[model samples]
Target chain A: MTKPDVLITGSYPEWDMQPMQEAFTVHELAADASATSLPRDVADKITALAMKGHAPIDGAYMDALPNLKMIANFGVGYDAIDVEAADARGIAVTNTPDVLSDDVADLAVAMLIAQARDMMGAEAWVRSGNWGTQGAYPLKQKVSGSRIGIIGLGRIGHEIASRLAAFKCEIGYSSRSRKETPGWQYFDDHVALADWADHVVIALAGGPGTAGLVSKQVIEAIGPRGILVNISRGSTVDEPALLDALESGRLGGAGLDVFENEPKIDPRFLKLKNAVLQPHQASATAETRQDMGALQRENLLSFYAKKPLQTPVNKTGKSYPR
Target chain B: MTKPDVLITGSYPEWDMQPMQEAFTVHELAADASATSLPRDVADKITALAMKGHAPIDGAYMDALPNLKMIANFGVGYDAIDVEAADARGIAVTNTPDVLSDDVADLAVAMLIAQARDMMGAEAWVRSGNWGTQGAYPLKQKVSGSRIGIIGLGRIGHEIASRLAAFKCEIGYSSRSRKETPGWQYFDDHVALADWADHVVIALAGGPGTAGLVSKQVIEAIGPRGILVNISRGSTVDEPALLDALESGRLGGAGLDVFENEPKIDPRFLKLKNAVLQPHQASATAETRQDMGALQRENLLSFYAKKPLQTPVNKTGKSYPR
Candidate 1:
């Protein structure tokens, strides 16, 4: 019998896929290809699929691959994948989470500090030789002792709070339920959180449930002197509302690691001086990506060996214990 | 009886000099006049003087100002002033040192994290829309768990170490004397410190003693993967050697807040993408500057009250150990 073929749709450390390649015949997609552009004929021969956040693994794609048995996602968020359809077809879907929490948390704090201090602006000022004429630029805001509000207190949010605690920030959070954590104050509504917070972070998962959670009311509540940081999915925020707040100076600044239409960011955001923009790379650190790749490889190997797969996303959809 | 008039050669917070004006008849100099070009008769009437770092308070000016009593320097590192001449004439000199320590430490850490993560480069890349063409950029070095070497573990150095402790970076130091501290390793020489550390920070004091401390040998020891951060005086580093190291890739990256001929930075440094340059603004925060102004005013008030000054420059000309 021909060995079961696996199709990998995302980039990972080459060594991580070596073990999976040894176990089965593998076809790797070009790093730049969109999900729809992958060769359709090859899809029929695929027994397992491997992918990252960018690829949409919906029911339509699942229908094309009749022999597909399982999917091992490279990172935590599976919002791009249609899990309900995969579940209906008895396809085991696994995601790599928890391994990237600390790395993303670090990036969130770095972005917050960078925005508060006007680091990018300062660098440009110095490089342009403005310092020679102006002597030294004016000072920026203080990061420590600022009031920080977290929108969602999930794994990554909690990690960010833990790191920020060391900086002496007052941590407040808005979540579905109140947490009994030591230093975190819980608020049930986003407006209340924004009204009190000097810095607001959107860390909610992206999906229909969380779409447009940060409305114009919340942005207005944050006020001028307040900074917004988004490391979570772009759909969680109202982009036009955020842009309006920034333009009107109702919001002091923003540090964005993700966008509503990613890879095609809103052009209006480029004109704002108080914004710090990054290419959705919160969890793109070498160590975190390596860990994610290793976990994804393990999930693929475990399924082939007829063992219980770790970090199953289909289980979450079924309301099973994760 | 004639009143002893005070002369201010540089700009100050209006409030800072109001108290001084009430105490003594104050004379303000033209803002743009070169210190060397001040009228001879105006210089003759000046008794107590207030000045910023850029003004040349040298031996020639000291000789010209016959009635000069005290030189209340506005900021730390009074390298522009001729301290030895002032000491010889029994003219007391004071600087706002400790007041700026925390602010400078904040910038040092900011620069360290910014440079290590290629934050400025990444920001520019995103703003220019190059990110879409370049999928995900490769990771720079990690800040956590990296070995950091600090030269001259004075107040600013200590504060930086304490702040970085939260990030879990292993701290090492090279100073004039060995000091005992938990989790801090002391190296007698900078070369050994550079050999052991992946990141080297120059926080040593300026003046003749520390001139040329970070020689070519030290730069070479801190091999290709090493990052260098200079928050200390620019004279401490040999810029030509640093440029050579950067060109040869012997040094990984650098974040420089001060330079050898500041305001006239070496044009070569401007051409490098790996270096993050600032206009000597380690203590440029508004809160820190306000504290410094208040401290300078207190020191002046104490001197007039015939009490010991708060931060008098030592007889040997060092500003430490207030």
Candidate 2:
């Protein structure tokens, strides 16, 4: 039997491919290639595609890949890929989810603490030699016992909530539907949750459905002395409106791992000292990245061997069924 | 009768002095004067000296102030004030201890987490635009659920232990004498404690007595996977030896709030990415600092009234004598 041809379109640490090479006939895509950048000839023959976070495998690219059997995403959040387009082509979609929950949650909390206490600003103050002549400046904001609101109750969101419980924060959440969980108070409305929470965290799914879900009204409800953290999709928030809230101090601070434009973040955000900006690195820890790569390879091998895929994207509902 | 003269040696925030001024004849010393830098002429007439952290009140200064009845310290450690000499002269000394415990403990945990995860380095990577091209690097060390060794289990140490308990960390400690605390394993020796702990924190008091408590042997025992956090006093750890450990990567990372020759940290420390350096600001939050200033002023007034000081240094025993 001919080995399944897998086109891997993400840069991984060199050691990551050792396992991939052992399992399949792997084709290395150009380091900078988006899903659209694949050559026409290669797209026609590719049996599987492995994608990274930056690449967008939209409808146009899905239509071009005639032989693609599966798109094994290297991380959680398949927003970059049009799962509906793949579904129309009868191609399976898989994501590495549970493996990254702890790591992403770690970064989320790290960013929250870093932003809340102005850790970065404090470090800079000391390094700038102003600390010696001046005593420490007034404290920033407090983190312990603050009211925290989570927007989405998925695997990663639940992990963040569990970790935050140790800090004595009151945890409140808003999901599409509520399920009973100890220590978590569910809110039926996101805007109402913002009004009551001191820190509003965006951890919802990334798709057209969730796009702009956290609107200007929700941000205004967060009011002053409130913080916003986004570890989920950037599109879930209205970036320009959020910026206005920050400028006016309607929101206290933000720890954003995802941005509307991501690698090309709003330049205005650079001017805001209260914002802790990251390059969409919620699951970027070494252990988690390696695990994500390994999981992707496992998904591919399982599909080839006629075994069940571990984490399919379209588990309960049809992807964009119309 | 004329009100007793109170000399404020350390600068208190304007708001901190309102209550004290309403009750005493206050002489404001220059806010920026270091203990050693106070003019001899000004020192001659001081009836009571109000000092803050690390403001040296040595024998020479005390001898100059013939009318000095008390030295009221603003924060916990009075290493700069010679307590033994003050006691010999019947000059009372007091500090604000328990009030700053929670705030200082909060900072200790923040520094520990920041150092273990290389937060400073990660933030710099993102801000410098290197993260997009380089991707996220391996975190320096682990903090959660790790074996944590604490030296000096006093109020602040106990506070840190309570906070760490919530994180599920295994707690081990070495103090002057073994004390019974639930869930805490006491080690008779520092080296033995270091050998077993993934992170070693120095929360011991500062003075001639603890100048070099954490020596090379103890640091070596901590090994390559170990982290060291010092929020107590810079004199507790041998700075030269710590620099060597970090240079060789024998110790994973360090989060320091105090230094042996503070405001003059070893330049070698600046070169290391694993070190999270803060300018001795453990109790530097606004609320804590204000509380400390107010407490110091209150202690001075109490001395004027021939009343007992609130938080006197324990020169003779395990606990402060009333």
Candidate 3:
């Protein structure tokens, strides 16, 4: 078999590349590699593009590599890759989905409980000699048996809801319409769900139409006693509004794994005692990432073999698979 | 009818005191109020002693209050009370149990996930501007689906096991004997259970026999990469051994709610990044505490009415009801 040359962009675990190396002549490129720096000879032969969410994979970049047949995203979200542009060029788009859901869901619940119990502050209380000096860490809220509302009842959201259900939490969700899944109460409007919930978790897919979908109104609707947890994109929330609400005690607290600018999160968030901040690492468990990397490799191999793609995001007409 | 003078020898929730004041002529005293400080004539009138765990209710102290009829403990684990002395004196000992189990279990699970996810470090990474500067936070171990071993499958341990079961965690337990609860693996030997589990949680009762139960041997058996969570009494585990193991990487991490000398804990545990230290606050949630306070009040009210105590720890020879 003539190994299809794959142009790998963005940073991944060094260990995860062993199988990629075995199956293809992989070209390691800086995520922001300029057109001139792109190896001209390798570009002509590159059939598959492997990249992370932070890496740029736009139409112009795809056009540069005319032989590109598919773009295999390392993580579930394909927001980094312009799906419409890839579709226009007849390039198949694939994301490692169900493989990473459990880790993401676990993280969502972990962060939620961390906030509910004030684990960060509680730890600080012990570390700073406060427990010994002052007294017990002040009482926080209980997480189990509370009402939880999940926005976007997708794979990751369902995983979160399922796990929370085990905690004896009342599960509700918001989507375009009611999902086929029974036992969960569905709200048409996101704001309505927030109003009815003790905690609102943002789990919707990130992209153009979804930007600021959990607006300031939804934040207020959830009220001061309610916590907002985001394991999804920061763009889905009105970041400034959230900051204002959190700072002013208009909202109770937050357990955020994602941020608006990311990495360069707001400086105000650093000082807030009520917030439990995390880097966008919901699925960054060693085990899950290893599995996701394997799945990404499988998607590439399946595309090359002309078989059905394991997890397709878009219908690139001729090469599309369920 | 003249009210029975009650000496509340310990701090309690301010909100809870309102009802206590209404029900009886409450004489508030410091948790460590000496035998002499108790008003002279009131001692004879005092029918019941409402105290917390820190307030000593030994035979010598109980002798000071000759007319004392019962000891109503504010929390579970009446280790401070000389149960044998109380039984010998024919004075009932009542503890607030079962009501606080859910909160304690919730905290155990919360701290477990916090340790598994490195939530403390993850939050710091975001807060200190390291997420943008240093890239993604490093991958951590997964909590869900991991093997969990619980010591003392009592009310709180049972709650912890039930919550973990929702996360698909494989459950094992160690106690004097196997419990009625099926589906959970049982180990009579504590060290054997620790050796088999990825995580070990302490939920045993605190006392002399149970002291150092989770000893150095059991900690070594858990080995590295295994997280230890203690929601039980600090006396239940050997603290010095735990500190040594955590410091030397003999154990991967810990989520501790108790210490050998609480509120005066050993300072060595402050700097360990892998640890998620809490202030012995397993049942410290506001909602749970409120419920616990209400239950304590009920026990006192029931005692005064010549009715059976609500949550009795030992028989009093007189009024004893469910």
Candidate 4:
């Protein structure tokens, strides 16, 4: 049997790419490819889109590939891919979840501790010969037993909360509904959670519903003694307010993995000593990325075999032609 | 009822100093003060010593202070102070313990994840505009579920192990005797522990018995895929071997907070990209430092009132004059 045509819309590691090439007739697009970037001849042959990165896959992009049956996203978040649009057109969207949750949670906890303990600055003190000439590094805050607020009690958030619980932290969370987690305080209001926590972590899913979920008031509530960590999406926060809070000392500090217009993030963030900035590599680990690739490939293979989609996100009934 | 004469042999925070000044006839000495450095007249009146930092308190120094009755150390590790000489001279030695365990353990775990994730390098990538110009940061190792070996399952090591359990890491430890810890595997030998673990953390007390405990053979056993973290004392590991391993990639990487001849640490360490260096700051947090200071002061206050030392290290019975 001939390999099915697969359109790859983002950069993937060679480990994923090499196997993908062997299994399918793969067509490549730049990670930053727009709807117009796809060649008309190639788009017609593409039946499946293997997606990665945060490049938008909207209705127009979907319309470009007429025979498109499925879109398998590399990471858990599919906000960049307009899922509602796909569902309306009776197309299926599948994301590689669970596999990347551990890596993301690890980075979230890492950033929280890194910001609290000033790991970056402490390392700088060691490297600059300041530790010898200037004596001990300036004392920073402690992490263990601090009151921590998790903004979303989803898969990743639950992992983060569980890990921090071992640190003897008081875990408080704000979710759509109260979870069954024992010993965790549930807050319906984000501002209240921020007000009570020494450190606040955002693990909310990104999309229109959560855009600006962490507002100016939330930032203010996480006051000067409170640290804010975002490992979710840049769109989940009001960047202008966050930058203002960080700059004015209204917020203690931030350990940010995602940012608004990231890569081209607000230049102001670069200037703040209180911000620990990461370039959206939260789930970017060798072990986890490989797993994510495997899962994405598995979903694509499942669709091809007419087996139930491995991890379906939307109900696109009878959309895939048998 | 005059206040007893007390000599302070190191730099202490103002919070500790102000109280010491108010309670006793406080005498100041440089943190690097030696036996010969002490003025004969000032030493003659000193009945107790309040210590901080890693300054040596030898028998010769004790001989200089003829009336010295007690030495209150401001940190958990009293390796710098000659405890044997203090024992022979019947000087009550007290060290601040338990107070700084959380902070030290927090840093130990922080360094482990930081090294694994290349957090320092990641931040630099963001700051250098490489995140914008160069694309996603390179994938790094995963921390969660990794095998970890704790060199000493004492107060601080137990804290580290407990915290790591939340990350779902497999915990193994090497201590003088098997502890009451249920899920943790115990190894009697250091090399075996290193061989078994993806990360080896040295949490042993910094004294003669434990000096060079993480030897060259152990470093080699950790091998090219394992990380070594030292939050204990500089003397606990053979620094030359550690340096050689890191330089040669005989070991995967290291997260070191202490080093031989630190401050003046080996220049080779600064050149390596694989290692994460901290300036002996495992217990250097504002909250913990304040607690340590308070505990040290409490011990000193107990000695002045003819009470038992709060955290005595040696048996110097009936030596302190009532």
TM-score of the second chain, each candidate in turn, equals: 0.91, 0.91, 0.96, 0.97
Clashing pairs in 4: none
Off by over 4 Å in 2: A30-47, A88-90, A179-184, A316-322, B1-4, B30-48, B59-70, B89-91, B131-145, B161-169, B177-185, B297-310, B315-322
Name the lDDT value of residue A174 in candidate 2.
94
Better of 2 and 3 by DockQ: 3
Q: Per-residue lDDT tens digits of candidate 3, residues A4-117?
A: 799888777777787788899988888768434686887888888888756557788888998988989999988878899998888998998887887888888888888888
lDDT of 2 at A308: 79
**Model 3 steric clash pairs:** A132-B263
DockQ of 1: 0.44
- Minimum summed lDDT over a 10-residue window in model 1 chain B is located at B313-322
RMSD of each: 3.6, 4.0, 1.8, 1.7
User: What are the runs in model 4 whose C-alpha is more than 4 Å off?
Assistant: A317-322, B317-322
DockQ in order:
0.44, 0.34, 0.78, 0.83
Model 1 CAPRI rating: acceptable
Write down the lDDT of every candidate, Cα atoms only: 0.80, 0.77, 0.86, 0.89
- What ranges in model 1 sit over 4 Å off? A1-4, A16-20, A29-45, A178-184, A308-310, A314-322, B1-4, B13-24, B29-45, B315-322
Give the TM-score of each candidate: 0.89, 0.86, 0.97, 0.97
Answer with 1 or 2, whichever has the higher lDDT. Answer: 1
Docking class of 4: high
Which residue pairs collide in model 2, if any? none
| Rank by DockQ (best first) | 4, 3, 1, 2
